[model samples]
Target: MTEKQREEAEWESINVLLTTHGLKPLCLVKRTDLKDLIIFDKQSSQRMRQNLTTLVEETSRQQSMIQELIETNQQLKKELQLEKCRVVDQEQRANDLEQILESVKSKVSELEDESLNRVCQQQNKIKDLQKEHTALQAKCQYYKKKRLEQEETIAFLQKDIYRLKKEEEERIVTQNRVFSYLCKRVPHTVLDRQLLCLIDYYESKIRKLHKQRYD
Candidate 1:
């Protein structure tokens, strides 16, 4: 809203023209020789008035259009700022996802290493168990050999016992036969003491013979 001011000379000239012919001057014509060319004719005055009015209307319209353009530009600036904030948020989310992915990969590597270690330990334990099993088998075989030896000894002792029993029975039968022969064949005129002494001597000789046979 800037106000336009005219000089005193130009104001006086416009006043003079209006009083002389009843015509309002819009502008003084720009000519080298004519510094104050005022339009006082009725037709020219009316035409100038119409042109000035049209110019005023066109200026008002242009001012309104300029104000609208200024408002739209401000709104565009606000939208651009919001878009920038959104882009920043999205970038932060992407960074977080990348960190999570790296952490998962690290944990997976640790788990894999643990699994391999466990597998190695299990293999060693299995090897130790196999060695223990082999040792147990050998010990079992040794015990079996000792058991067989004991069995053989027991059989030998049983055979020796049977032989001694048979020999004892044969000696008893021979003693009975000798005693019956002595009772039947002894002389009736021999003295009882002499006969008893002869029986004792024969028993001693039989014992000697039996001992020699054993030797």
Candidate 2:
């Protein structure tokens, strides 16, 4: 039963006992019976005082528990605000990373186009060199020299292609790192840890509040 209900029941029980035992002035009682009634009334008063003290103590404890719950709720709200700020910052970073990635992609496309143009130009030069080497061979005097120059030109074009490939690979690796960093769900920061701790603390406080309410 609720405290109020229990208190009401106790008061009703006390009134019923007094009436049943003829302790009221309206009813006559023997002297011995009157003394017993007095003692019983005194003991009942003492018991009621003890009950009042316990009720006051319980009420004080509940008030403290409620105040603590309010403080904890406020703390949790502050932590939620911090979490929201962190999320906004992370979104901004992700947007910045996307912009950077787009810039890198544009650069890569430009480089690829330039490399293809260079390859076409080199192929045309190789064709011209071959024709000149044939002409030199027909002249029979500088054939060996023309052949050596054509080989060197071919080697240089190969080196340029290899260098471009390596550069493209490095760009890909950098883009992957940026993507991974942006896609991570949680930010790695003291603020995140502090927010998490605050949430846990408030959650525990809520549980304690529930326990106190039930108790």
Candidate 3:
């Protein structure tokens, strides 16, 4: 057997012997030694001391394990507190984002309303412009019709004026021919004088008619 196993076997044997003798195990102290244990039953006391040493080593190991567990628990608690703080920060950020989104939505709604109103106003303006354009088109058509009528009247008047000018020219030509025939046919002095007087009167009348026609 191993040394530690042999020591445990010896301690077990000593524990049995002490129990059979109705002896209770003694409390161990830090200063206990084999020399001090020599006052007791030798073999049993040595085994008891060895067992107490093993027990103290085991208790130290247990205390070390308990300390490790306490440190681990504290670390876990610290981490949990940090995680809780992060959660609270995230919640606050989420609430802030929600409020910002709500404000953005409100602003967007107002913008949409303004845009709708602008669109309506623009549409109304377009309709008014269309109405004005239509009125202008009517006025333009009326003016075109009046201009056409004036052109037609001017054309008719021009044709009438041309016909009257032609007639006046023909009458002037016939009167000139008649005056030539009268001058050639009439040769008596007194009769010629009377004819010249009649011719002069007729020329004055023609001149007045020409003046009236030109004016």
Candidate achieving the largest lDDT: 3
Residue 215, candidate 2: alpha-carbon lDDT: 100
TM-score leaderboard ranking: 3, 1, 2
The RMSD (Cα, Å) of candidate 1 is 11.3
lDDT of 1 by residue, 89-161 (tens): 8899889989999999999999999999999999999999999999989998988898898888888888888
What lDDT does candidate 1 reach at residue 111?
96
Error of model 3, residue 107, in angstroms: 1.7
Name the regions of candidate 2 deviating beyond 4 angstroms: 1-40, 141-215
lDDT string for model 2 (1-215, tens) is 75544655565676677567444312222244343232335556565566567557767998999999999999999999999999999999999999999999999999999999999999999999999988977777566677788889889989989987875665445444444464554535676555545554655577589999999
Give one digit per residue, the lDDT tens place, for model 3 in 1-215. Answer: 75544655565676676667555553333223342232335665676677677678878999999999999999999999999999999999999999999999999999999999999999999999999999999999999999999999999999999998986777656555666786665334776666655766787689799999999
At residue 93, candidate 2 shows an lDDT of: 96
Q: Give the TM-score of candidate 2.
A: 0.46
TM-scores for all predictions: 0.48, 0.46, 0.59
Candidate 2 clashing pairs, residues 3+ apart or interchain: none
List the candidate numbers ranked by lDDT, top first: 3, 1, 2
Judge candidate 2 at residue 136 and give its lDDT: 75
Instruction: Pull out the clashing pairs in model 1.
Output: none
Model 2 local distance difference test score: 0.69
Model 3 TM-score, 2 decimals: 0.59
